[model samples]
Target: MNAGFDVAVVGSGIVGLGAALAAHRRGLRVVVIERGSEASGASVRNFGHLCFTPQAGLARDFALTSRELWLGLALDAGVWLRESGTLVAARRDDEFAVLRDLAATRGVEVELLTAAEAEARMPLAPGTAVGGAFLPRDLQANPRQAVAALAAHLEREGVEFRRRTTVGAVRPGRVETSRGPIDVGRVIVAVNHDIDLLYPEVAERHGIVRCSLDMMRVAAELRMPLAAPLLTGWSLVRYGAFSATPAAAALRERLHSERPDLAALDLNQMYTRLPDGTLIVGDTHSRGATVAPFQAEFAFESMLDETRVLFGVDALRVVERWQGVYASGPDDFLIEEVEPGVHLASATTGIGMTTGLGLAEHVVAAFSDDVTTTADEPGFASAPTTTLQKGAS
Candidate 1:
């Protein structure tokens, strides 16, 4: 095996791949090491929503930068990217109020439309939507395909990848892997929910926890061209920019009163259509480093029940069900130097797809200095309290 490189990335998720790209761009010999044969974690399990409209502060900046990177890669790497913005359906007066408040406060390009208008623009059940907001900047892609394309692109560009290789230990100038030890100049471990395996002390001290969510995919009744991803009243309160609005408290109260069951599971309904005429819907959030092996049937039931009410559809043909877990910490992401040349970068929240690219750039930059010790690097200190909010938003 080629054990020599200027930089070694210890995971193949979006953040890891992004770091490898950043290092290669700086003329560094970079190699990505992955325990799995392919990218099979949160990066592939997400909704693939490269959404920035709902982000605020530093997260918004990162999302914008990542969006540019995604677009360029989609074109250059032949990855499928759908220019689908988000259409949030407001089924009640309170939800509409929250959307209006968000539109006014967040200076993004948003359009307010009547129930009829929203239904006409997107395929929703009749009279189900009272009104909605159309955010035009959001985009979508197939998470599974995007990650594969990205890794493939890196390989073609001279970056090396050692799959099915686990890192046993990380130190200043060498990585002890399951296969063997490799000499490396710098090491960045971007492992997502499994950071404890490599740096338990760092993960625990940073207050990092795992956030698990339920997701489902179903067959569409017909081949309908979905102009954008569809969201519901729950989503109005799920996203940060919308939930932070003064009107959000009232909306949440209404939801709790009207549909306590959905509130219990943290259920939020949003659907995106695949090219094969299937709809991907889901998700409920539960926080813990270790989740139960079993999935609750009620979670899926709540999602489907809400989908029926919002879309006014009689039934949704359930196809497949699964779960995704990501690391969640005190901030948008946790970046700290655990050793002199080893840095740990993990997006503790769910916006890995939205901000992973830009975060990787910052991670690589931290190693750009001439100093040998991490203490010499200015940005190697503890991570900042991210201004971006975490949750469904």
Candidate 2:
């Protein structure tokens, strides 16, 4: 292979892939270097749900643009994107009101439904559900399949992917990898959490921090199955994006102050159905540098316990389990050209899957001579080691 290229992208996660593809589309020669044999980290983790729900207004615009970008890329790449709408089951009346507000919100096409209406669509939904909000345009995909398809598509476009290569040092116009140094005219560091490692003081400048959580996949319950990626009242509290909403603020205060399990446990629930008829049950967050040992028995019982209470599906069998981590910040996202030819970006929030393409596309635009200036942009706040949100779990 050639010893150099026009641009070098670090990390093969979705964000890195998004940036690489964007740059390649712009006619720049690009090479992607990843540490693992294949793309890992948060790329192929979680529900693979293309989150359509807006994060205030920021995610609204990004997600809308990202949807268009994702659809276009999948069409060109022949990747399968499931049109699985998201159902957010609201347990409280206030939760239902949030759905009403979201229905009127721009970017996201939400529909508020009564319990009967929601159950009619998926009769198997928990009878305990009082009502729900459905995002009709949201979708899902197999993360591994999509990323692999994307890599192959990039290969077809003559884009180079250097797998099993680890980057140790990043400099302007050059990147030093485990394999060796590669010369380039521009560099984009999309290594996700390792963003802090590459830019050791990144935490100080970019405010990069990590959130660790558990995710599990469950087998189908015989003939019955879930209709889509479903989130109950529990999930609203788990994901800060929802919890941070106006109504969610009151709920957050209650859970933080009154509820013992919620305040101490920080448990949030998300259940997404897979093509194989299995349900992808997840996820609870605890923010810290290190995570506790995988409590296989606890995780198993805990998730299933939640599933039983939240979902009506019975006889659901456990199939697979895994853990995931990602970068998130206090504000919407950390998007800035920290240095010339060195673009630092991270989706510490769950928006990586929800809004990655557009965000990466934005990075590509910054690579231009106009946006790639040396001066830092104003009003763009840096992520601090100590944030007002108490760091995500």
lDDT (Cα) of model 2: 0.69
Off by over 4 Å in 2: 123-126, 222-224, 238-245, 253-259, 369-393
Winner by lDDT: 1
The lDDT of model 1 is 0.80
Residue-pair clashes per candidate, as listed? Answer: 4, 4
RMSD of candidate 2 to the truth, in angstroms, is: 6.0
> How would you encode candidate 1's per-residue C-alpha lDDT over 1-393 as one tens digit per residue?
865899999999999998887787667999899999998999999888877888766666667767777777877677789878888878788989988897788367788999788778877767777888899888898898999998998999899999999889899999998889989999999998899888888888888888889999986563236677887777777666777888999989988888888888787678888777778898898888797768989898888877666566776799889998889776777877778888887777788998888777767766775212244322222222244344334
Residue-by-residue lDDT tens digits, candidate 2, 1-393: 547788888888787888887777667889988888888788888688887663444554556656766776667776668787888877667667566655765555677889888666553445765788787788887787888888888889899988888888988878888888899988888887777777767665655577776788887553345677787666666453465556766665655665565444456677777767777777766666444556446655777776775555566677777777777556556665667778876676766887677667677765554323122322111111121223231
* TM-score, per-candidate, Cα-based: 0.91, 0.87
